[model samples]
Target: MKRNLREKTKRNIGLDLTRIFAFLSVISVHFFLNTGFYKIPLRGKRMFILATLRTSFMVCVPLFLLLTGYLVSAKKIPLEIGNLKKYYKKIIPVLLSYGIGMTVIFAIYRLRGDRSYNLQKLVFGILGYKEYSWYVNMYIGLFLLSPFLTNIWASIGDKKTHLALIAVFSLLTVGPTVFNVNDLTSLKAIFAAYDDNKINHLLPGWWYNIYPLTYFFLGAYLRTYVDFKKLRPAKVFLALILIIFASSAYNIWRSHGGSFQIRLWNSWGSLQNTASSICVFILINTLAPERVNEKIERFLAYISKLTFAAYILSALSDKLVYSFVNANLGSVKESMPYLPIIILSSATLALAMAAGVEFLTEKILEKSVREK
Candidate 1:
């Protein structure tokens, strides 16, 4: 019954697996994006199947938020200058990670002779955080606020109070997102006045942008409370599948057999995406052993560290893998049978490149520090 998670030095194999899977899910989503999965018409079972896969992998970003809450919520950040310094020291590597990632990615594009990123765009793009670095931008804010968020969660008087907070946050963030409609024209024939952003008219959409906080509080809740043994993992797995299928089916139906648009529950704040990430996070922690082989944990620990860099550098792998595949196959539909392999190839390359980049960056930083 340790109250301080920092004191618990042993690794949670479940979290390691979660981190790796989340990074893979990120890469997998790009597989869909680069291959034009969205352009495929929702005709027959193929779109449904592919959409279902896409829906399942859509847990990418939320998983990281939940992981952040679980790992950081129990931190003991006191009101002291030393504590603040220690706190920020942890964030510097992440900042460095993004910097290295953005620079490396920008350089790769420049080297490849991509005219889109000229000298001016390169400076502005990296300074503005670039397109694929949106998650990094979001995470930097969260990381900065996590200490205060931890204080709020830790100050709660009781489990009931924490549950109430979770409920209210859910209403403000998840409710609006899950209940909203993206396409107004499709509904205009029926509702006449319906347009974008009307479905959650009563739910208060002002706070919907803070959905990451909802998942964060959720992870904090699970970390501080919740008995994993009591909740059946089998039931959870079934619910995960059901939610994925239901969400995917809703998108198919909403699309009206047109281009497979992610119209329903495909967002970070959507209920289905939130629930799926939670379910997988819970199942892994509950099912995985308390400890793993030392050798394997060491390997996974290294890989887990690289997952962030791998994610940031994923566009490099995506371009390399998809460019070749698409040139050969002509379309995503024609390459349906090789979807899994293509995804694996892309993910593998990202990890491989991340290993090199992370190692080289570490050595470079170490050398700079030594010189200083």
Candidate 2:
């Protein structure tokens, strides 16, 4: 019994550390995106440095989905109203924080004499729509669809079918996305006939965006069936190194010539990105220790509480933070010397702001509910 308890504690520590890594990676990705670090007019050494870091963190979103699947599957709970209620109980507080943050941001935008508010923007912000929290929206969709998803998983009961499903999703989402083949004659003509309005074009775009669900399923399947802990560590490490190298090489090669937008879109959906993400997920899971000291465990727990808040609030305030950084840093050379410092400072600032906003908002909401 004592041995079992020790093993379980170790597993929990591993899981917590992965969540923390995923949280930090997401922030790092946003830092690059908002600051336009990748698009900086740099060459040779500077560009190489930026590209390496960018490639390293490309696994952020996939890691998130995989972790989500791993935890949800471990629950082995019935996907009923209670599950959803529990989800919303957690989600709504986060959304409320996001809403409060956005209000302040929009007010700042207004104060800056920028009156570009539109109906679409309003709806997106108010409804927590598919603008910034795209992942959150996708996860919510999965939550709503969990019953059917789990039932299908149980019914299939084979690895081949799971692989087949993954392949189909990849073809639909990753294939067209990476290859930039959505505008092909076949696809265009099909979409032209299907919708004169051209809303979805030829293929159903929603099906392609179901990549998160694919990751969720893949993560759950691996956790349930794969004894990754028993795998040869040397081989797993080699495979991970190869995957990262290939993915980074492919990204560098593909950066030859394109507008930044085109490059960004393709890189995010590339096959190499998928391979790298899965590799990182497995690497993190397999290498996570079965034990950690109390100090580390407590630190992980504290930061994990702020992950969702950090994501939403940072995203909402990215533009402002970017502007502030650009104003202070001025040029690449000036900022390059202390780039790590800048990133750490900005991330810390974001975390502090997110925590404050969440705490105050939660109190206000709770007080209002109590009074009513």
Per-residue alpha-carbon lDDT of model 2 for 1-372, expressed as tens digits?
998886665536656767778777776777666666656543566665666667777777777777777776655446577865765565566667767766655666667777875545666675764335766666667765665666566667788887887677777767645444333456545333222243323444445666777777777787777776886667877887787766555555545422122342345545666777777777676787766777887777767766766766665455666677779876444566666666666567667777777787879889988999
Model 1 Cα shift for residue 242 (angstroms): 1.3
Q: What TM-score do all the candidates reach, one by one?
A: 0.90, 0.76
Tens-digit lDDT track for model 1 on 1-372? 573653387787878988988998998888778888778787877667877888889898999999999989978887577887789777766777777777777788888998786768867876787758888888888887888888899889899999999999999888876555544345464333333554445467788888889989999988888667667889989988888888888767666777766543467888889888888888877787776777998888889989998888887888888889999986767777898898889888888878877887788779878999
Q: What clash pairs does model 2 have?
A: 10-290, 191-201, 191-202
Which pairs clash (backbone N, Cα, C closer than 3 Å) in model 1?
none
Off by over 4 Å in 1: 1-8, 115-119, 182-200, 368-372
